[model samples]
Target: MVEEKEKREDLPPVNFSMFILSLNTSALVHLGELPDPHSQQKKKDLALARQTIDILDMLKEKTRGNLTREEEKLLDTILYELRMIYLRVSGGK
Candidate 1:
C-alpha cells in the first residue's frame, strides 16, 4: 500500500512545495518569463497564466483548515507573488 501510494503518479516524492513549484513554472512560462528549454524563447500566454492562477486559488480554498501552518503560509505567499506577476504581465487585465 505504501509503495502503491508512493508510485501512484510516478512523480517521485511529491510534496506541497513541488506542487507550488510546478504552478510557478507554468505561470512564469505563460508570463513570457521562462524561456522554452527546447527553443530557448519565451512565450507569453496570458490566458494560460490566468488559468494557472485560478487553479492555485482553488487549491488554497479547498485545502483550507487541512494544511499545516507552514504550508498555508507558503501557499499564500506563492499565490500572492503569482497574482502580482500575472497582473504586471497582463497590464491589470
Candidate 2:
C-alpha cells in the first residue's frame, strides 16, 4: 500500500476545481464522449450520464455564492456543454 499511496501523492492537490473536473470526466465517459478508463472503449450510458450531470447541477446550486469566479464559470460551462451533448445523443428526448 505504500507504493500506491506514493503514486496517489504525486497527483495534484484535491480542490473544488479538481473535484469538478473529475465529475466532468465521468460524465464524458458515460456519455461516450470519452473512452472509459477501465474498458478503454466508448460507450453510451445515458442514464448514468444524466445522473452525473444532475450531480454537477446540484453542486452548482448548493455552492451558489461560494465558488470563485473561475470556478463558477467552469461549472456553468461544463454543465451547459454536457446538457447540449446529451440532448443531441438522446435525440432531444
Candidate 3:
C-alpha cells in the first residue's frame, strides 16, 4: 500500500551499521534474547544463532581496516555481547 511504503521510507537508510544491527537482532532472536518477530515468542535455536554470529564474525574479518572507528566499535561490541550471551545460553559449550 502507499501508506505502508511511505512508512517504510521513514526508516533509517541502509548502511553498514544498519546491516550489522539487523544481523545482531537476528542473532538475539535466535539466542532467545529477543522474541521471534513473527511468532512473538522466545525460542532458542543455538545452531542458527551460531550461524548468524559466524556471519557477523566473517564480516568483521573481511571488512577489517575499512570500517570507520564507530562502525568497528559497534561490530566488536555486538560480537562480544552475542558471544557471551551464546555461551550462557548454551551452557558454556
Candidate 4:
C-alpha cells in the first residue's frame, strides 16, 4: 500500500544528508581528492575547496539545535575529514 508508494523511484528523496553529500562531493572535487567526473582529471583548487568547506561550516553553525543526531554526526564527520585532508593537501595552510 503506502509502503510501495514510498518506495517508488519517481519520488525524489530530499533530505539533509543528501545536501551534505553534494557539498562533500564539491569539496572533494575542488581539493583534487576526487576525479572531476566531467573532465576525468583531478585538479587541486584549495581556494575553491576552502570555500565549499566554509559553506558547510556556515550551514553547520546556522543549523545549530535544529538538526537531528544523524544529521549532526554526518556534518561533523564530513567537516573534520575534509579539513584534515585540506590541510594536508594545502601543506598545512
Report the C-alpha lDDT of model 1 over 1-93, residue by residue, as the tens digit.
989877787875679878877888888888898986678899998998889989989999999999999888988998899889888888998
lDDT of 3 at 47: 99
Q: Candidate 2 — worst ten consecutive residues by lDDT sum?
A: 84-93
Name model 1 segments beyond 4 Å from true: 1-12
Of 1 and 2, the candidate ahead on TM-score is 2
TM-score versus the correct structure, for each prediction: 0.81, 0.95, 0.96, 0.86
- In model 3, what lDDT does residue 35 have? 98
In Å, residue 47's CA in model 3 sits off its true spot by 0.4
Our model 2 lands, by Cα RMSD against the true structure, at: 0.8
Residue pairs clashing, model 3: none
lDDT of each: 0.87, 0.97, 0.99, 0.95
Off by over 4 Å in 3: none
In model 1, the Cα lDDT at residue 16 comes to 83
Q: What is candidate 2's lDDT per residue for 1-93, written digit by digit as tens?
A: 999999999999999999999999999999999999999999999999999999999999999999999999999999999999999999997
**1-93 per-residue lDDT for model 3 (tens digits):** 999999999999999999999999999999999999999999999999999999999999999999999999999999999999999999999
- Clash pairs for candidate 2: none
Candidate 1 vs 3: which has more lDDT: 3
How do these models rank on lDDT, best leading? Answer: 3, 2, 4, 1
| Evaluation by lDDT, superior candidate among 2 and 4 | 2
